[model samples]
Target chain A: MMQRRPMIGLALMAVASCIAVAARLLVVRTLDGSLVVGWPGPTLGQFRVDAVLVACSAGAALGASGAILQTLLRNPLASPFVLGVTSGAGAGVAFASLAASIAGMAAPTGAALGAPALAGALLALGCVLLLSRRHGALDPITLILGGVIVGAIASAGSTVAEALLPPERRGLLTGWLFGRIPEVPDMGSLAACAAAALGLTGLGAAWGNRLDGAALSDDEARSIGIALGPMRTAMFIGCGVATAATVALCGPIAFVGLLAPHCARALVGARNRILVPAAAVAGAGLLTAADALRQWIDIGGGRLPLGAVTAVFGGVAFLVLLRRTAAGWMA
Target chain B: MSALRFQSPIIARGAFMFAPGEVAPSAGRVTVLIGPNGGGKTTALRAAAGMLAPEQGAILLDGAPVHTMPAAQRAARMALVAQRPEVGAPFSVRDVVALGRVLRPASPERIAHALARSGLTQLADRPFHALSGGQQQRVAVARAFAQHEPGGVLLLDEAFAAVDPPEAAALVREIRAEAAAGATVLAATHDLSVASALADDVWCIAGGRSTAFGAARELLTRAALPSLLGVAVAEAHGSRGTIAVADYGGILPEAPR
Candidate 1:
């Protein structure tokens, strides 16, 4: 029976991935009746495909990162966004764009955006770690509070940068800030994000047993041969990198990271091996479906932001999960 | 079984310091550590298990310093069951037990045997948090048992405190069986009767120091119990056995340094 759970979860993940792909294809079919052959210019179908790819990759990254973050922090609500990685990345890009504009330079693009974003993420992570540590231990309440403070500061900085931008460019910046999926104009950036997400997810899954042991008391985990310091450091860095990559490509889409892991935990148990990948697939399916829904809504001249769609669903899921938690549904 | 030797002064944060001492747990024997609350008993056990590094001297397993050895290698040679081990997630009893196998190769037979020995076969499918405190302690015992290596060292800190008598007796039997099979088993407990009945050797700790180390029957005397526990103690002898009872003296003042 124990062995069967992982197998079932694996099957569910496969189905979810297929559904995500189908959802993307469905969006493409709706946008353009069929696939366009040669490209003199980017077709509507091509644009939809890029959106789907970015959403799925970003979703997968957030899901995997959330699983690790939750385990490390020992808090069910911990995720990339809640922990400030997304806001930090947003600040980094905004600061870089502001600097470039002041120097009368064209805005940074592609891989150029990654360095500053990663720096900002690591900085926020450091602050969270430092502020939350008390008597050589990480207190959950302090950690969350620290993350919130860092996020707020970074958000304010990003807002200030937006105010400095030219009026014509303000709409585009605001759209990104609201967590709209970016069109991956270049294949190179897409490949880089995809590779990063997959690589980090593999690393997280490989450490599953240690992660399980880590859920125990620090003394017990140490007695059981887990190098707690190294394991935690690795998890933090892996989650940070994955979150930064996603935030750099797509604006900080809230809730996919927080919601997917909880959904996976319901499907499978709390074992990190199954939970990590299952969450990844769930996130992919969720974001892909959300993007499709966004396209379907078409409320105004532009489609609704993918982030807004996910937040609504994710917000509702969060409340329900919180209620169940309050009633002692989780340990 | 491998001999465990602690030759050091161990220090635990927010706790008393263990003065320099040497503990030579005999091979194939059940060595029990008895002490008053906060007497550094847990600190000693943790040092022996390699969870706490000594500020001075060393803990040696098979004559090699445990702190110097690789973590996995050290863990392969011993298992420590903590008092009130944390169950932070909704893991099944079997899953919690399986965590013990991290240092060794996976073996279903070994896991099954451990569960049966701890009498947890019936509760293997239950979530750990759903179990009673005593049941949770038993699950910890099962996990340590599953992780046992041939002639390995097992250190348990108040592992059976929450368990009822019958189940505690069964666990004691399991510990004896392990010792007879050549494992060095060291346990800490406040229950002097259980310690005296099962231990081949007893180490009495008081005021963060080892006050006595010898045969359990000889060391756990009525005269020693009162001073060690800082209260009045009475030993009642019946046809069944001898039980040492202590009277609460309204929390005796801290022992003078």
Candidate 2:
């Protein structure tokens, strides 16, 4: 039973990703193919394909980040949005947008790490809030409260920036705020995905045992010769880096960070080796599926925010799990 | 068994740390800490194991300061089993016990030895959370015994409270074995008989201070038990001490010592 769990998680992720990728390919060829109305060149067609890849990569990054956070914090509620790590990045992006508009400069023309640095700072703030409030490590209430506060500030900053920018630049500002996968392919998104993946896998392997021991108690983990302070800090930092990458690409898609870990835990169990990788794949699968649905299904004239779709699905799954657990099904 | 010389400053809200210069636990025997409820006996033990920091004292293992050292460093020298442990979820009996020994994927032989020594070998595969309170305490004690490193200090905080008298005695025997194997064992307990049978030395605490620190036999006298119960001792003998309570089951009203 112990050995079976990790395999099951890995297998489930592989299956989900394969299915999502297949659906994405079909959707790009059908619905998105019809949308290319001009005398489309091969290079133009390549843009749509590239967008799918970028979306997939972004999804993967969120998954990996969520997994790492869940294990490190040893809390099911821990994720990029819930922990306020991405709020830092979101705040950074919002600040950049507002500053560029005020200066009459082009959007996306600021320091490349401006947004990510903001994210890192927000993450640091969340850490301080959590650590200072009687509960040394991240507790559910503290993390959620911190995230809500930081998120509100970031949203307010984005709103003020949008209202101030002219209509011409306002579209760009909003796109950045809501997150858009540009048809003009940039390596930043791909690089962010790679970094998130590497961080997730590396930390997952090195700290897996210590992470598991942490679920017991700090004293118990310490008694086992695991250095609690350094290990916890490294895990949180790794989660932060992963969150920064995903936020940089996806514009702080709210509930995926909150949803992915719980889904992964439900699929497998609380074991880190399974939970970490599972969360990464599940996050990717969820985002990719949502993006694919956005391209395939015509809601209005333009695409719906993939975040909205994911929020609905994630919320439904969360409710289902809660109900099932209440009814004694999942325990 | 080598002696544990604790020196540290433990400072926390609702906790006090005895300065290293203030107290040094003598070694090579069982040192039982007896105190009133909330007299900080558990906190003191936690400080000694580096689980909690002292506000002003330095902990010494074999006369070396361990307060500034990382918790992992102190772990190599000490192990602790908490009283009334809160273990979540269901795990096999062996898995629960194996948690005490942090080294992963425990060997069947070693786990068996720990269980048999703790007298729970027959229930090795039973679900731990399903075990009776007495059985669970034995499992916890077995884990402590398995984690016992030679010359290491094993600290137990009110460990015997959850067990029956016979089971506690058996558990004490395993602790004595750890002592015989050269580990300094210090346990805090409200159970006087358990301490009397197992401890070689005693540190009796009350009102946030050490009332007595001497041979276990002397500190386990009829007089010391009453202090633990907030009364006076009236009798002492070979293996038992009788406290002359004012009321004996309401049969004898008040007895003057």
Top DockQ hit: 1
Number of the top candidate by TM-score? 1
lDDT of 2 at B55: 57
Q: Candidate 1 has which clashing residue pairs, if any? A: none
> Native-contact fraction for each model?
0.53, 0.32
* Backbone clash tally (model 1): 0
Report fnat, model 1: 0.53
The CA lDDT of each predicted structure is 0.78, 0.64
Q: Can you tell me the DockQ of model 1?
A: 0.43
> How many pairs of residues collide in each model?
0, 18
Q: What fraction of native interface contacts is shared by candidate 2?
A: 0.32
